[model samples]
Structure formats: structure tokens, C-alpha cells
Target chain A: MKRFWCLFFMIWPVLALYVCWIAPSMGWWFPFTGPTGMKAASPLGERIDDLFYMILYITTATFVGTQIALGYVLFKGAAATDEGNTEKAWYSHGSHNLEVIWTIVPACVLLFIALYQMDVWAQYRVKDSFPSETKQGAIAEVTARQFEWRIRYPGLGPDGKPLPLMPEPQPTDLYTVNDLHAVVGKAVMIILETQDVQHSFFLPELRVKQDAVPGLDIPVWFKASKSGDYTLLCAELCGWGHYKMKARMVAETEDKYLEFLQNLTKSQNYDGVPETPAEGAPVASAAE
Target chain B: MRSKLVALVLCSGMLFVCGCGRTEPQFSYREGLSPRVQEYVRTTVDEKFGTPHKIRVWDKLPIQAHTALATVGEGSKDNSLVVDISGASRPIEPGTEVVWVGGTIMPRGSAPVTVEAFTKDKNLLSLVAAPPAAPKAGDKIVIGPGQTLTHGRLLYAEHCQHCHGVAGDGQGPTAPYLNVRPRDYRKGLFKFTSTKEGMKAHRSDLARVIEDGIPGTYMPSFKLLKPEESHAIIEYVLFLAMRGESEFQMNNLLASDYSDASVANRIKDGETQEKVIEEFVTRVKEGEIDEEVNQRNEKMIADWVSAQAEDAVIVPKEKRNASDEESIKRGRELYLSGNLNCVACHGESGLGDGVQTYSVTKNTDTGKDNVEPGLYDTWGNKLKPRNLRLGMYRGGRRPIDIYARIEAGIKGTPMPAFGAKLTEQQKWDIVNYVLELPHELRTPGTGVAPASPATKPAPVATTAH
Candidate 1:
């Protein structure tokens, strides 16, 4: 029984290592392949995954080494108690070099991870890194309110004027009070706000999540890679109806998106006249 | 043994430390349901008519049937109370008169009502009635129909004042719960309907909404009021909202006139306040202020209200039948086509997935995208639109559900109220089309095969000059 117990203890770490190393890479039990069913976004997600594997391998090795040392100590201590070979058990001071090696190695590993992770974080969060000039551009505003997310898109009218955007500091520009949609392939900046409480905007496939803060603006950017229906869900608990605040988002080709927008604009009846800028007049800058 | 004892003690200490985390509040269905139902009844009734004097059960036993008993006046000894029956968990068989007696009657300006309910077999169900009324400092002003101002003010204070504020500033306490906050009553821009086309919401559109609360929001239905009461409330709410909006516009105008340094200096010298007040009074008396400005603001607000009314028009009682196969076919074609784009947001398969599923963008109004989730039904429940293939609609399997949604557009979301855009016939056709989407798009030999027809593209809209 004792021998069996020892063998079970010896095999557990190896099994755990094997499962951890092979499971995700093999995609045996993974769900939700990120966006395009791909492994990572940017080179950074892949790099981080690589670093994760490296740590896993190193830790597995260290665990094996420790197990071996423990086994050896247990065996040696038990065997040294024979009466004929009885002697004062040798007491050795802990090795300063060993302690130094373990401490320095872990410190170096942590430093490497910290430095590498900063770049990944910056790549995802930095607004400047956005590929705003791409053909399939990002032009959508996400408004998170109590238990619901309201999306707005600037639908162009018949004369080809884009509808006014909202949360525009000028009270007059609070146009399209609620209808939110935008044309495809246009660089759209979404100004986020909350109506009653805090909520979050999470797009899993786009790998973007931003909090919907009331009395403040939290901006997020993402370009749809394909024309498909994606889901928008609240990631925060606003109230009892939090779970029901689900909506659909459609990313279409430029022509199709524009066509959709035109249909919406034509159908909607606005009370105010369209605010047209004078020809050759200087355009007002957005609020800083 | 000593080491083992230490290890046990340490493990127990760790467990205690871990257990110190805050306990999460558990979801309670019963607690949430009762209050929601009660609030829904109260708000709906009050909005429909003025506050009721005594809302009680009608009978002595079998307390299933409840009624709203409102008194006509403060001190009339006659049978001034009008009792209207409302609410039933199960369908009430025709001619079944379920009543409960011994229910306490609370006066409009008095203390609480304590009532009890018993089964036909004498078992008790519940005893609680109305909550106690708070103390009032002044004698209640009795306003009759002829006194429109007094009547409007009394009604507004009772119903609209809680949310619209005493000054009509839309800063109501309950305003916080609404998704699309309560109409500031001061903006006068009703987002739901339009009246410019000589179209008005049929009486039922307003009454039904007051009866059958908006499905997914804080707006609860006031089903307890008689038809007359509901009409009165609607008028009262509208009057308050418009009056507030006009006042707000006037204030803005006055503020603009005092902006100049000389005007400011005069105000600083304590003369400007009286001058501004006099000017305001003169303008009110003359009523000849900027006609264009007033027209523009009025039109803006009128147009919004018109849109809401248009959206709220459910199919007339006559057009709800599923008789027109051709219209339904056309509706199906439209649903599949680019126009109405229902398939895009709902889904091609009618599973609510077209091109835009799970796509995240910011909301134009609130500025936060990543919206919570999509369309739900009444009952504050989450219900995805039926997969067209499945042919099931929780809102009722009738063609009217599809029609009303297409026409009115679901309130409080991205669903643009489509009433103003779609013709009444087209709306019905769309409903027929939605009902047929699942079956029409289904595979052949799947029990019920769709009638074969050529796929038609959406008609291109000619720009209105």
C-alpha cells in the first residue's frame, strides 16, 4: 500500500504537466475560437502564449526535481537507521549558492514576463496603434445604459449627408437621439456614457472590452473583419434585467452598410431640419 | 503529533480567513415578482386615471379577482366609487364572478387599508391591503372639469410630479429606473409618435399600453382603470409634458436676453430681475412671440409625439386575420431582402442572426456600445425572436405580433419604430411574412413545405423631392 501510494504521488505531477501542455494546443476541449477561429490577435497574443508555455515547462521541470530530492531524502533517512551502521546523522548547513540560484532565476523570469507583457498591453490599449486607415474601418458608438447596450451608426441621407452624432457638447447636435448605426469602412469614434449606473461593453470576438461609465467617456475601437451578425451583451450587473440587455450588431461591406443606413434614414422622420454647414466654411472641431 | 496538531490548526485558520469574504445576495423570484406586479398596477392605474380612493377585492371569498375602486369625490355619501376588475393568473371563464369581501377600504386622503382573503373552504391567503398614506399639510383643492388649470395641476402633482419634478424639470426619482429616461415632460419631444400626417393614436393604443405595460422596461401597465380613467391620465401626462417644455423654452429665451454686459450690469443693480419678469409676463400676455420659433419647437415636439403614436398603433381589430397569402409572401420577400433589414439583425434563419450578430459598437445616445443584449418580450423576460424555421412566437402565434413589432418597432432599443414608414398593409404583410419565414426557408420534405415562389428583391426607394 505504501509503495502504491508513493508511485501515485510520483506520477501525478507528470500527468498534470502532460495535460496542461497538450490540451489547449491540441484544441481538444477549447471553446470559442477567437474571431476568425484563430489562435491569437496581433503577434502579441501568440508571444504571450509562447511565454506561458515556457513557464509551464520550467515549472514542470522544477517540480520533478523537487520530487526526486524529497524521495531521495526520505529513502536515505530511513535506510541510515540500521544498528550496525549507526552513527550520528550528518547535519549540513543549507547551501547559500542554491538559495541564491533559485531566487535569482525566479526574479529574472518575473522581470522578463513583466517587460514583455507591457508591450502586449500597450498594443491592445493604445489608440494610435489602431489601423484606422484600413478599408474595413471602425465607425460605431456603443452606449451602455442600465441593463442594455444601445449602438448608434451615422446613416447618410439621400443627399449623402451623414446624420449628426450625439453626446456632441453642442446641445443642438444631440441628433439621432437613439438610433445608432454607422457606415462600414469609415473611422468611427464612439463616445461612451452611462445613463443611470456603470456597465461594460464587451466584444469577445473583437478582443475588446470597455466600461460604460456615467458622467465620463470611455472609448473603444475595433474593426470588423467579416460581415456577419455579432452579439452585444452587457458585462456588468446594472439591475434585475441585466441579462436581457442583448443586441445584435451587423458589419457589412461598405456598399451594403451604406445602403442599410440609407434605408434607415429615409424611413425615420426627424422633427428638426438637417443642420447643413455653409459651403467652404470652416468646420467646427470636436470637443477635446 | 505536535506537528500534525499545528498543521490542523493552521488549516482551520486559513479556512476561517477565506470564509470572511462577503456573501452574495441570492436571487429571489417571489420577492421580485410581488413588488413588480404591485408597482405595475399602481403606476398604470394612476397614469390612466387620478389616484383611486380605495382599491380592493370585490368579493368576500376566493380572493383571485381584485378590483380598483376609485371614489368620484372627497365627501359624497352616494355610491361614487367605481370598481373596475383587473388581473388573473388563469383565464377567467366568461360569467365567472370571483370576489372577496372584508377587504379594508382606504380613503384617498386617509390611512392604510388592511384586508384579508380566504378560500371558499375558509383557508386564509393574504390579509394585507393598501399602504398607509402620509400626512398632508394643506386642505386638498377640489378641481372640477370646468377648472382646467386646477384639474391639470392636481392631476400632474399626483402622477407626473414624482418623476417630472414639481417644476416639470424631468428630474423625477423614478426617472433613474427607466432605460430611455422618462420624457422630461419639459422637452415636449415625444419620441414614439408623429401627428403631422393628421394621424393620431387610436384610443386603444394608449389604453392598451397603459393596460399591458411595455414588456422590457420600468413602464408597467395600468390595467386596473376603467377606459375613461385611462383616457384622462393620458391627457394629463401629455398636458404636463407640454407645459413643462414651453416653460423651459421661455426660460432659455429670457436667459439669452440678459447676456450683454449692460444688461448684466442692470441686473447686478437689482433692476434686471423685475425687468426680465415684466418682459416675460408681457410676452405671455401678448402671445405674439416668435411664431416661427414656436412653430419650429412645437413641430419638433409634435413630430416626436406623432411618431410615438404611429408606432403604438397595433393592427386595427379588423386587419388581424391571416387571410392575405400574397401580402404575407411579399412580407417574407421583404424580410429576406435588404429593406426592413430584419433578417440582418434577427438572422437570415430568423434565429436573430443575419450579418450583425455579436458585433459591438457604441450607442449614439449613451455613447457606450457593447449593448446588453437583444429583444425580449413583455414580463421583463429575455426572449430571442423565434427562429423563423421553428415557427414559434412567444408573443402569441398570431400574425399581429409580427405586424405590431414591424409597425411600432419595439420601444427602448435599436428597433426603429417602423409605423411612420411602413404602410398599414405593408406592416401586416411583414407580419405574415415573418410568420412564414421559418417555414418558407425550411428544407423540403420537412413535414410542412413552403409554397414555391420566385425570390423577389426589395423595391428601390425613389428619393422624395
Candidate 2:
């Protein structure tokens, strides 16, 4: 029974280590697609994942060290009392030197981590540190309400180029719900706003998360390395229907992105009546 | 210690039993119906459309019943059975699965019987295997290669029941807290539709609403749902709407003579209680009420069928005019024009604060002046005109959507159709103006003079919260 008590404390950390070793292969690491588990689909997201793995390594080392120390003490204590030896137990009230060493070592580790992650932190949250392309203007305005993401994109100009997205909704703005499209391999920005409550816009694949505070316009930027659909969900529990904000962020080439905008414009102006011969003249006149 | 372990296991087993004892979900009837009326509605609806677990598709209600219903006929052997497939929506094919919905052939377990061979002309179905007991004549069976309604009911319960209610009465758990209530399909009326005025909404209109969702409202988009799943949900919604409409029509019939107020009035007019009660019993026995209900149901079905006709959809004669400054100027003139009277409900500057909103109006039903000074829809909810400056079009934001609104008019609201009075070009002009209202600079009344200084200033348009 005494040996059993010693074994119980030692078994958990070993079991935990086994689970961690097998987790990535089992596709149980990060909430993403890929066999190796640490799959970040954006350039910035890759850097973020590096920082995440760094912290995870530090924590795992600390956890293993503490657990071993605990198991060693339990094992020694249990083993000493296993036999019927008449011996007085040795106990101490305090160990000042050991306490000082333990405290100072953790403080140094904390300071090192604080200094190491400064660049990634600045790139993620600081507006001035954003890429040059994103600094020009946002491509779309994403307004998060209780249960949905309403996206507004600037309509095409006469030259067949997208107009700069306006802060306020323009008459020529194209509207869609729960679908966001952006050019791949380049930073695209979106002005995020909340109509009612606080909602956190989270793109799991791109590793981007921002809180859409009411009455505040927050700019969020990300560059997707792959051209595909990524999951966009709300991280904050804004309301009962928070799960209903299941959206998709599509990353494509510049030409394809522009083509999508053109299609949106055509659909936005569709008037049930098929395009008549007279329609071409007005479009030409407007272009001129 | 061993005894403690046994007790612990027993306690956990009890908890597992409790967890497994979940009650089945049920659809609640609309409130305010008398007990008798409620019972009649329940029995009639249930007989046609069975419970959620054993859903029966009533083919006459303009709903797409995916499964075929057939009654077992004579000369049924152990391996095969003859069935009358006249009531089915389509011919049941070979290899289709079958389940007994009525009579003595009870559903046994998870696995259902499948068809080995189907003779179309003879209406015969040979089973792949024999059941524990042979099926009897007159046993009702449902043939299903498609389980649309069942799939829809389960999905609706999981996703839509929180707001749309099990009965589609718009009184679900979260409904009361919402400012814009979920649609009550009981009246068989939808506000946003592309169909012409006085017609039921087209299936595509409902499908669009489900896919894109109604912006500026709590109904979120279900764009992630697969195409087949969406079709099933739409069919289930149609079933609920038809069922609710039947109950509503029956309520209307009872309202004239059997309402609480009507009963009290009869007693006040010196009629004995027994005599008044006898009148109701005699009417029920004579089947007069049943005849009335059947007629109304037929009319309702006809209305639903006609709405799906190709010509029922509204298509503009001409394409949209250009969005140039000249077109905008002409649209502004039409906005202030007395013939269109756009300023009546929509204010002079398109603020949705027109005088009609604050004026007392007579109630169409009671014929008395309403206590509240506001416009109301047929559903008795206070109606507010769309504030053009918001740029949030609930139906849709497309130019064609706005044109349809201007031409056919939004049903069940104070907005009226101008297609009969205005030409297609004029309607397009209004559509362009309305589309540009958000971007247009706000000036006090533009050209129109402000009301006399004595009158209260018009309400300012506040930003949506």
C-alpha cells in the first residue's frame, strides 16, 4: 500500500508525457488541419505559432521538473516508512537558501520571455507596425452584430477597379453576410465594428483574433499564404446564438478577388429584367 | 471498502438511467384557442400530419411529401404484399425502404424492411425479408428513399426551434427578447417576396431568405447548410405553415359564434345556457363546420398552388435606368411628387418620419379609432417605415430587390403597389433615388417648407443601436 501511494504520484507525469508525444501524430494539437498539428496558413500566423511553441516548451519543462520533484519526495518518504524501522522523522520549518534560489530562477525566466515576445506582440496589436500595404486603407468593413457578420465591400469604379472602402456605407457598396474574401499572399485589412455587443472576430487558420468593441472601429490585417476557405467564428460569447456566426474567409489571387467583386456588383444591380439592348448605352455613357 | 465500491457503482448506474430518460419534444398549439377548438385542431392536424417521431405527410397541403404513403391490400404473402399506391406522391421503386406508420404492423427496431422488387402496374412490393408477424390488410406503410421531412424536423429542432418555435408560431424561447419577432408562419403571409401583390411567397423567395438571412434582423444566414439539407428544412417550414394556417382558419370560423365574447353576448340576449350549448352540438353533428373548414382548406391550397405559377412572379418590363446625376434628379422629383405621394409615409427627406406615422388611424377590424397613433400591419404589430438613410434593406440590398419593392409593394404593410399607376421607367427612377438616399447629403426638407413653427418638430433619425 505504501509503494502504491508512491507509484500513483509518479504515474501521471509519465502518462502525460506519453500523451504529448502522440498528440501531434493523432491530429490533436491545434484546432487546424494538417498531420503535424502546428499548421498556420499565414506568414504572421507562422511566427505566432513559433512563439506559441516556445511558451509551450517552457511550460512543459517546468511542469515535468516540478512533477519529478514532487514524486521523488513522495517516493523517498513512502520508502523510508515502508519497513518497520524505529526512527524519528526529520522535519525542518524552513529552507531560506532553497526558497531564494527557486524564486529568483522563475523571475529570470519570466523576464526573458517578456523580452523575447516583444516583436511578435507589436506586429500583432500595434497599428504603426502593420505592413505598408495594409496602412493604405481597409478593403472591407466587417460589422459584427449579435449573431452574424455583415461584410460591406466597395463597389467597382468605371475603370473596373475597386473603389476605396468608405467609413460609412456608400450607395455603391456591395453587401454580403458571413462571407469574407481577400487576396492571398498580401496583407488585407478590414475595419471591424460591433452594432450591439462585444464580439471577437477569430480566424483559426490565419491565427488572427480581434475584439470588435461597440462604437469603436478596429483594424485587423492578415495575409493568407494559401488560397482556400478558412473558418471564421466568434471567440466571444456575445449572445445565445454566438455559434450561429459560422462564416468563411476565402483567400484567392488578385484577379480572382477582383472578379468576385465584379460579380457582386452585377448581382447587386440586377433588376429581374434581363439585360436589354438599351442597357449597354447607359453603361457606356456612365463610363465616359 | 468493497461494499463502498458496489454502492458507488450503483449510484452511477442510477445517474445513467436518469440521463437516458429524456422526454421527446412536442409541438405546442397556438394560445388563445378555446379547449374544444384546440382539441379539434390537434386531432385533425395529428391525423393528417403525425407526431414528430412518426411524421405523416398530408399530400394535399401544397408541401413536398418526400415519402409515399400506401395502404396494404389483400393477397399479402410472407415475402410480398399488394398495396394501393394511389395516395402516394410518386411511384415507389424497387430497393426502397418501408416503415409501418399505422395499424398492427409495428416498427420493431432500428433496422426497417426494404423492398426487393416493385411491380408498378400491379402496385405490389416484395420484401427483402419477412417480419416477426405478417402485415395485415389496411395497414398503412410509408415508402421512403428520401427522408426529407424527418431530417428537416430534427435539424429544425436543433437550429431553428429556439426562435421560430416548434409550431413556427414565432414564440420560441429567445423570441420574446427580440425586438423584431421571428416570422409567425401561421397567417401564411411573408413580408418580403418577389411575387406580385396578394400572392403567397414563392419557394425561391423563402429559400433566399434562409440562405442569405434577413439583414438588420436576428435571423442569421444558414449558408453553411448543404443544398439537400436546406431543401428539407424549407419543406418542414412549409408543412408547419400549412398546419398553422388550417388552425388559424378554423379559429376564425369559431370566432363568430363560439368565442367567449360571443357566448357572453348570447346569454345577455336572454338565451338559455342549454339552448346556446345545444346549437353548437347540433352544428357539429350536422357537419356544417366541417364543410366550412374543408372549403377554406381548398381555397388556401389553391392560393398556395397559384403562387408557384411562373406568371405570379413580378418581372420589370424595362431594365434599370442609369445611376447618373440626371436620373437621381428625376428620382428626387418623383419622391416629392403628389401623384406617387412618396412623402406621405417616407418624409420629405426620406427620414421615415412622415406625418402618417404620428397620425391616429382607424382600426380596420374594429372600425374604431385606435388608441395608438401609428401604422399597424395585418398582424397587429406597430409598423415603421424604412429609414432610407440607414442603407439597411431587410428584404435585400440589390437594385432589383428595391425595384420589386416599389413595383409590387411589400405585402401586409402600409406600403402600396405603384406599378399600376407608374410606368416601369418611373419605378426604376424611384429605385435609383431610394438606393442613393444613404449617400445623399441630408438637408432640411430640401425644397419643401418645414411645418409651421407651432407644430412639434419632426422626430430626428437616430442611429440604430
Candidate 3:
């Protein structure tokens, strides 16, 4: 009975590992967000995904090893307990060698990983370290307010003003609410701000999330390889109306991007004379 | 003994495996909430549409466990019989039996009994063979204070609950933050319904709102959602609207019937007043007075249900008046005219800051009005009349959309229908005036004179206004 009990206990650690890690990896249900996270949409996202898998592999191995060791300890101790040999180890001396080996091994492995990940981290976070090919001046400034995103683009004549509806944006600044338009294959930059509280400008597929803190102007950039309409969700719990704080990111060919801006401009200004700009749209900056 | 122990271990091991093998039971529409809500199970007097209802739970609670039981009365839109947890908090799994105040649940076709749970508790719940014929004011109406969590409720809680209140009152957690508040369905009214007349916001109208959201508001188009899922949401929204309407009616009826003045009128003097008051109270409790209330309720429910009748709309008799400057000039003259009264609600500058600024008055029944109103809509919340200076239209900004808004007044709001009062040309004139209000207001100095044909700027196709 004792042997059986010990054996059952021995397998529990293994069972847990199998259920939490192995089963999920085998498609039983890991990636609890559903299936696999949609394939990353940008080069930066792909790099992030690669880094994620590398850490996952190392951690998974360590987890399986630890659980197996736990099972082995229980399995070997079963015989002595069953035979009524319940004796305590009196020797207080710890195995310094074993401790050193375990500690040093993990430290070395982690050090190597940290050193290897620096480049990817810098490429993503450090503006100065960004690829020269993707560099572009601020395309638009997005302001986050209660339950909506107010986006402003540079308009013609150095002043953000409406141009006639045409296939081409008259190099004039434009503005829109709850929608962002950008040309695909070209790196785009946006200056983000928050009118009221904390908001995370999150693009899940692009693997981009930036906090828009009140009293701060944070710049974020991304390039879309594919042209399509994607979602911009407020990842932060800004307020009760956060769920409705959804915006559409329309990434397409240059022509389509211009077309979208033209239509929005018409809607924003309507008449040649300026009326109240699209609700939350900001007044054009003179310097820009 | 060893063999016995092995057998016991084996038996337990097998039992454990068997327990792990069975998955949570899948619910068929018959066995669960989705199909039940999809069908006309609980309906208003019209029976053409089902009564609206939804489950209420705190956002923190896991949506799966809670369920609701509604005591659906035949032919009457009774949204009473609310079921909720009493105590012992824990995550409930499938098939948990909930006992109600009116009696333990009985299977379909079981004979109805006068259970103490029903008569004793004001909930007045009866699942089988309809309910007791008469319901008095004293009878507790329980239109789902709680329900067995249904699939529809789950969907609504996830998608719509944050903005639309748990009961569809449009007072959700985020409702306060929005400049333009969402529609409160308690009045069972929607602003832009599909048809007008018999059924308010017909089935298609609800579907349209759900699919293509209202413009210039926080509402978004949910066209990406699957057909079945959107329909489920539609049904759930209706459930909430109907439930809210039922509660609204009940409150109104009780307040009027049991007012202090009415009670005083019942007893003219102290002498013989005790006996007379007792009789009056008895009359109220005996369901005698309910007959009249119920008749009124019938008309109210029918009016709500028939809001979608085809004839309930206003259409232009002739083609839209040309949007030329001359036409715009004609439109502007009528806009500032005293008869139209556009300047009263919409100010001189058309900034929506007119004479009705923050009109505060006491609610007669409650004698307390916390709400300060620029203008109160059907939901009793402050509504900002659209700033005509900004050509942002809530219903839509299209020519016909704007025209229709003028011809027929926006339902359940301060906007009145001009179709009856004004001719088509007159209504068209109003639409043109509204559309051009922003332009005229923007260039204040460039008014009336710009009406000359030769002096007028050429039409710009890009000019959305």
C-alpha cells in the first residue's frame, strides 16, 4: 500500500508537467488565446516571435527535467518507506559542488541568452538603432481621448487644411477620427498622445503596444508588409467605454491611402470654408 | 487482502479515468437559452416579436455559471419573475438546479399547482399551464432579476455590456464618458428604426443598427460578426429593451395608483374613512384595479411593437429641391423664421446652445430631478441637440438621410416630425437649411449676397456639405 501510494505521488509532478506543457504543445490547448496567435505582421514582430520560441524551448526542458527528478526522488524513497526504514539524515553538510553546478549552469545559460537578445531589443526600442531603410518623419499624430482616437495628418501649405476630394492628397495635412490610413511597404510613424488618462495603442497582429500617457508625446512606428484593414484596439483599461475605443487601421497602396484621406478631408471640412473640424481633430500646428 | 486492495485501487483508477473522459455537456437550443430566445417564447400583446431580456452579473463574475428563469405569461408581456443567487458563492457548472421562490421547477406538461412559493412570494412564478389569471400591484413582478446564464446573455455581457447597461438601460460602466449617450431601450424606442408605425424598430431595424452602427457616435459597425452571432445579439438586445419597458411601465402605474393624493382622495374624512380606505386598499390588492392598468399596458405594448409599420414614415412627395445657392438661400430664410422655431433649440450661431440651455425642473412624481438638461430625451438624460455648425449627422449625413430626419421627427427625442406641419418642399427646405447651416454659420459675413447665380461659386463635387 505504501509502495503504491509513493508511486502515485511520484507520478503527480510528471503528470502536471505533461498537462501544462506537453499537452498544450501537442495542440491540446497551449496558446489559450485560441489556436496560435495570428502570424506576426511585421519584421519586428517576427523577431519577437523568434525570441519567444527560444525562451519557451529552454524553459520547457528545464521544467521537464525538474519534474522527472522529483519523480525519481519519490520512486527511490518508496522502498525504504515500505520496509519501515523511516530514518532521517543526520548529516548537516550540504552538497556545495552540486549547488555550484546548478547555479553556475543556469547563470551561464541566462547570460548567453541576455547577451544574444540585446540586438533585437535595441532594434525595437532604440530609435537611433532603427534600420535606416525604414526611417520616415512623423506621418501623423494620434491623440487618445475618452473612447476615441483623434488622428491628424500634415496638410498642404504647411498648415493642416482640407484639400478637394481627389485621388491624390494635396500634400496637405488631413485629420480623421477612429481611422488611420497608411501606405503599405513604407515605414510609417505616428506621434501618440492621450487627452485624459492612460491608454495603450495596441496593434495585436503587428505585435505593437505603446502606452499613451497623459502629458506625454510618444512616437511609435511600424511598416505593414501586407495591405489590408486591421484593427487598432485600446489594450489599456482607460475607462468604462474602453471597449468601444476601437479604430480601423487601413494599410494599402499609396493611391488607396490618398483616396481614404481625400474622402475623410471632404467629410471633415465639407465646405471650402472651415467649420468645426472633425469633432476631436486638433488645430493644425503652424510649424509643421 | 492484497488482492482486495488491488481491486479497490483498480476500481478507483477506472473511476477517475471515466470522470476525466466525460466532457461538459453541449446544450441544444431546446435545452439552453439561444434557441429559446430566438423563438417567440415570451412575447408582448402583438406576439409578432419576443419580449427582450438579458442576464445581469458583475463584470468580475465568470459568465458561465449564472442562469435566469423568467415566468412568461401568455398573451401579456410580463417581464417578472427574476431569479438570482441567494448565498453560497461558487463557480456553477452545467446542470445546477436552482430553486425558485414560487416553487421548485417542474418539467413541461406537469400539472400546475398553487404552490406557496408563487402565492407567498411576490415574484408570482408559474412555469406550467400559464400563471394565475390576475396579478395585482402587491404581486412581486420578477422579470429576471437573475436568470440561468444563457448563451445570449454571455454574448451580450462580452460585447454590449460595457456601453449598454446590464438591463439595456444605456447606463453601462462607460456610458458616462461618452458625449453622445447610447440609446436607452427602456422606453422600447430606437431613433432610426427600419419602418415606422406598428412595430417600433422592426426586426430588420434592430439588425441594421447592430450591423451598421449609427454614424457620428461611438457605435461601430459590427458587420464582421457572424450572422448567427449578430442575430443572437439582436435578440438579446430586444430582450433587454422589453424587460426595461416592462419595469418602466410598472413603476409608472404604481406611482400614479398609490400616490398620497390619490389615497387622500379615497378617504374624504376621518369618520368612516378607515373603512373606506380599507376597501380601496382591498380593491387594489384584489387585482380589480389591475384590469384598467393592464388595458393601458396593452395599448402601450402594441404602440411599441407596431413602431415599424410602413406608414409610420415620412417621404418627400417631390424630388429633392436643387442644392443650388438660390435653394440654399430659400432654405436659410425658413430656418431663422419664427414659425419653424429652429432658433429656439438650435441657437443663433447654430452651436446647439439655444434658449433651452440646461433647463432644470422637478420631476412631478419624484419631486426630485438630479438631471440638468440642455434637452432631455426619452431616456430622461441630457441630450445635446446636434450642432448644425458641424455637419455631423447621427442618423446619417446623406441627402435623403438628412431629408428623412426633417420630414419625420427623430423617434423618442425632442426632434418633431415636420411632415404633418410642413409641405414636402417646406421639409426639403429645412433639410437644405440644416445641411447648409454649417457653411452659412462658418462664413457669417458671406451670407444672402452669395445667393446670386453669377456671383455664386461653382459647385464643388468634393463639397460633402
Query: What DockQ does every candidate get?
Result: 0.01, 0.37, 0.05
Better of 2 and 3 by DockQ: 2
**In model 2, which residue pairs have backbone atoms overlapping below 3 Å?**
none
Model 1 over residues B114-163: C-alpha lDDT tens digits? 33332323212222332343212222211121122333346555555555
User: Share of real interface contacts recovered by each model?
Assistant: 0.00, 0.44, 0.02
Each model's TM-score?
0.36, 0.84, 0.56
Question: Relative to the unseen true structure, what is the C-alpha lDDT of residue B130 in candidate 2, on a scale of 0 to 100?
Answer: 77
* Per-residue lDDT over A167-266 for candidate 1, one digit per residue giving the tens place of the 0 to 100 score: 3221111122223343333444465667668887765544546677666655555555555554455678777556545554455676776666555443
Total clashes in model 3, counting residue pairs 3 or more apart in sequence or in different chains: 37
TM-score of 1: 0.36
How far off is residue B146 in model 2, in Å? 6.6
Error of 2 at B456 (Å): 41
Off by over 4 Å in 3: A1-38, A58-195, A215-232, A241-288, B1-154, B157-184, B192-224, B239-261, B268-306, B310-341, B358-374, B387-402, B418-465
Q: What is the TM-score of chain B in candidate 3?
A: 0.57
Task: Report, for every candidate in turn, its global Cα lDDT versus the true structure.
Answer: 0.46, 0.79, 0.58
Summarize candidate 2's per-residue lDDT along B339-413 as a digit string, tens digits: 988888888878898888999876766777777998777667777788887888888977778877888788877
Judging by DockQ against the true structure, name the best candidate: 2
Q: How do the residues A192-229 of candidate 3 rate in per-residue lDDT, one tens digit apiece?
A: 78878899898776778888888766667787667776
For model 1, what is the alpha-carbon lDDT of residue B368? 61
